[model samples]
Target: MGKEKTKIRLRGHHLFCSNVMDVDGDPIYSARFCANFRKYQQMMADPSQAIEVVCTCGDTCRYCPSWNEQDGKCRLYDYPPNANRIDLEMLEALSLSVGDEITSGELKQRIKGRFGTTLPAMCSWACGFESVLHCSQGQRKL
Candidate 1:
């Protein structure tokens, strides 16, 4: 018998934020949306590999009214119409493929440059977090 290779699935938002490490230096998500993404980030250095993607909504979808629990997908998947466009553009800008390996710093810098804000700010805005850390601190205007 051969060992089974685990397939890593990534949602659109993972491209923007890396996993946050806990006190013990363990990575954790603020929500339940990105198990495979977190794992993929941990395992792969180049993110160009083929990956299954569900949506770009990210962790903020937890509180979104349009989140379709039954399907485990986003109701607003095409709401912005350009949602996929943005995701593709972001991937292209970062030079990342579905499973291509990349450094966290490099990904963050690419995201910051493309979005004109910090990753936390981007996550906050995407997830609709009430307190946007960067904006609140006046670090970088979003």
Candidate 2:
């Protein structure tokens, strides 16, 4: 993947993945995730906005609509305990030893096509709904 430029203000910002996914188990909307990704990369470039990560979900989680029927906790299953919030930790951990800044280039190479994309079904419904809601009147930005 080629080098893609990201903003500076959002650099080093990170967000933990919530249990927001679809039946097929793909990320529903990349907005929050991608936004954080951009922030992390930006922080890497500038080194001023270094941030930490927190794992709210404990472990062994995944979202499955049929979880109850399958005798499984699909919601928890969809979101693993510590799997989602590793990005910020990874960056903080990496900063101790690494001297050079982490560029979007490296991130792209690591995530490959997985970055900057949203699952089709989830994106259309959930993401679309969110986009509409965010742009709607009487709604405040959180």
Candidate 3:
């Protein structure tokens, strides 16, 4: 018998970015973003355990035109003493770090504090949804 495939359960914020596109203007459903997201998703599946956030810097930045591949950094956010830094400040402010287990509610609260809003509010500006249906309907929540 073949091994069963694990179903990846995604949260609300994950859903918000699930339909985001990549640099080539293709849906990121099967990309590294999904892989990384699944990693965290698996960890957070246990309600009693604290979820370990690998990084506060969301994957959406990878598709941004300003992302510099050569240096593995964002041109718009990187500066001296903070080279290759994405959302470090936000992460630190929220007291979140790699391998630190945290509750889902805690995670959501910190995310809200960092962005000063919800994922949908932020996605409206960052995500470039090519489909008219997605843009019109999806962006309405922003």
Candidate 4:
């Protein structure tokens, strides 16, 4: 059988998660969001390394130019970091370094289970919201 291709869907401009605390040796929020950064560029130099992210919104992600024209649903905005569809090969490689090997996925979930920054996601959402072609002035909550 041919190798199965992985598809990574990145709807937002950037990815982020809460940081883990250092005291309990919890996964840092920055570390979680930036796990790929920890993998070192050499490891991800290959376009095949990838990760799957669920965008709260579909491909119409407010940021894409095609959003309004296509009713917030379009393929142009959905793709792996390399512009290719999701590729499991890329994710497997990234997991080796960024994510710990767990037969059932990482056992240690929730970075310290502590939420430090509530504004980051809001900031990100606001940014994407504004990028929408039809957003009204002063309509942004942030």
Question: Quick one: RMSD of model 4?
Answer: 16.1
- lDDT per residue, candidate 2, 30-119, as tens digits? 454335433343344343333222232211122223234343323322255633233334335334112234333343333223322332
Best by lDDT: 1
Q: Report the C-alpha lDDT of model 1 over 1-142, residue by residue, as the tens digit.
A: 9765444454555455433321122223333434433455555344443344344454334434566666556664534555555456456666666445454445545656666634443344354432432233332422
Candidate 4 lDDT tens digits, 29-138: 23332344233222322445443344332221334333444434444433434342222222332233222222212211221122222323333432343233222221
Per-prediction TM-score: 0.41, 0.22, 0.37, 0.21
Stretches of model 4 off by over 4 angstroms after superposition: 15-28, 36-142
> Would you give me the overall lDDT of model 3?
0.42
Give the distance in Å from residue 60's predicted Cα in candidate 2 to where it truly belongs: 20
Q: Is 1 or 3 the stronger prediction by lDDT?
A: 1
Q: What's the CA error at residue 51 for candidate 3, in Å?
A: 2.0
Ranking by TM-score: 1, 3, 2, 4
